[model samples]
Target: MSDVTPKHAAALVALDWGTTALRAYLLGDDGAVLDSRASPAGIMKLPAGGFDQAFDETCGAWLASHPGLPVIAAGMVGSAQGWVEAPYVETPADASALVKGIVEVTAANGATVHIVPGVLQAGAMPNVMRGEETQIVGALAGDAALEHEPHGALIGLPGTHAKWAFVFEGRIERFYTFMTGETFGALRDHTILGRTMRATAQQDPDAFIRGVDTAKDAGHAGMLATIFSTRTLGLTGQLAPEQQSDYLSGLLIGHELRGLNEVLAREQSNLAGRTLRLIGNEALCERYRVALERFGCDDAKTVADATERGLFRIAAQAGLVRAAVRVN
Candidate 1:
């Protein structure tokens, strides 16, 4: 642990600890971020018995600065492979359900840690989501328009496995997952298409736009047949090698947007014409926005750092911390 002094007493500590990275945030009494620390100690990065040691190394100083400071974590840190398996909270539920599902552990020095639960949707096509649930909670909690929307909101959290949640009132009604980003990665790094795709293939706007158009035109019925066009376009001398990556990105994201539109239309009519509030990093959200606009869902907005907002709300609701911010 680095020897440093905290400028402000931390009201609580929040973590958006996931599969590949761990980010910690120190927040004040008003739920505003104060300071933060980070580590590469994602669950996958730690050894069998290293979670405790890693936590101590990363946040022990903050803990020392504020004894018994409540720590609330969300993401794969609560997965079966994490410190403790915080079970899934069923859908058609609210943030209260998340608070109810929290699983805790005690550090050797006696600090308490809370792991937020993932959300599960059970039905013909079941779906599960972890960190994204908290992002959704924070997004809704931070936006009064969304928090009080009469028709509810459609939340799209784009990442490796993008999650589309339909939140009505204050509860998450249901959600679906699209492995769009992961699929793009696989195609770019492991498949034959990668041979022609160089690093310069990213941000090729023309190729990406074409890919989105192809996905929309193909719809779900022809999706299985559409991806091959990435290679065929190159073979036919239509797609340049440098544009392959961007093209592939467009095709997959297009497929995701199209699938989301169809699923929402079929599953719930109330979502028609409503905007999708996107929660994620700026780049991915922009990509989704382009596809959504091309696919006729024009109003897509982005909310950065929803993960932090959510951790604060969950901790406050659970009485793990006292923040003056209102979360309804």
Candidate 2:
């Protein structure tokens, strides 16, 4: 009711509200990014109703610049912790089902706003994911290599809680989330690992690969034994304290790979002739690729910024924006 009207009614605004920051993208009808803005407001930072204020401040800045453009958002912003708790649609959902249109939220000034719903997976066990679904779908759409193929694709999204999903015939068939990064953080920083190693030694690729190989060979139960081996190796003058982080990284990555392997094996019969794609941080993707290769799946391809590209593609398919946006 502030009396501001947008220059164009059809302009689309896409927001990626993450754990640490809030980012907004202004897109034209063709999905081209016209302008962008961001702020320090993230859901993790604001444990309370802080999201409402953060969102208002961030989007207010964008509205101040564009006058009155309709906005659509995805990610943790749709969770119970966000500005408005948008419910999640189950997996194997299509673009139409997945694309929960803008839910009108009232701003501090009484202006109307909208939020996008996250994706949830259910069965004997229930699992949920926010924000990454857009990216997963977007990654599938952007990769023409995937579209040309007829079979389903296995996508791995690495993060604090890494997600692995299957996309078939333009729908998300099923997915799983692993608390790899979070577990690593907990074990390294909060546990005995932190006390025994330097902060900077956590990312050694050699150690990571060794961990994957160990997990691939021994399975998850073997992690405790392996973890203790690091200490023993260091005590025996066989492994350095700096190398202790690598040892820990190996144990965690290995455990995660073991679980992922089980998921792949169960789904393999259903996927007789499909391809696998790894999407996440470059280095992490490489780690997955190495682990997967040992399992005899040689066709895994890796891509960067897959989530952003995936979100853009979903927006395009929903007609929220046009398909001409270059998602680089």
Task: Supply every candidate's count of residue pairs whose N, Cα or C atoms clash at under 3 angstroms.
Answer: 0, 3
TM, every model: 0.91, 0.82
| Candidate 1 local lDDT, residue 255 | 83
Model 2 lDDT tens row, 184-254: 78887777667767556256666656666666676656666666665676678866677677767666766
Q: Which candidate is the best by lDDT?
A: 1
TM-score of 1: 0.91
Once superposed on the true structure, which residue ranges of model 1 sit more than 4 Å away at CA? 1-9, 148-151, 267-273, 323-328
Give each model's whole-structure lDDT. 0.83, 0.68
- Candidate 2 ranges with C-alpha deviation above 4 Å: 1-10, 47-49, 100-102, 109-111, 148-151, 201-203, 220-222, 269-274, 293-299, 322-328
C-alpha lDDT of residue 127 in model 1 = 94
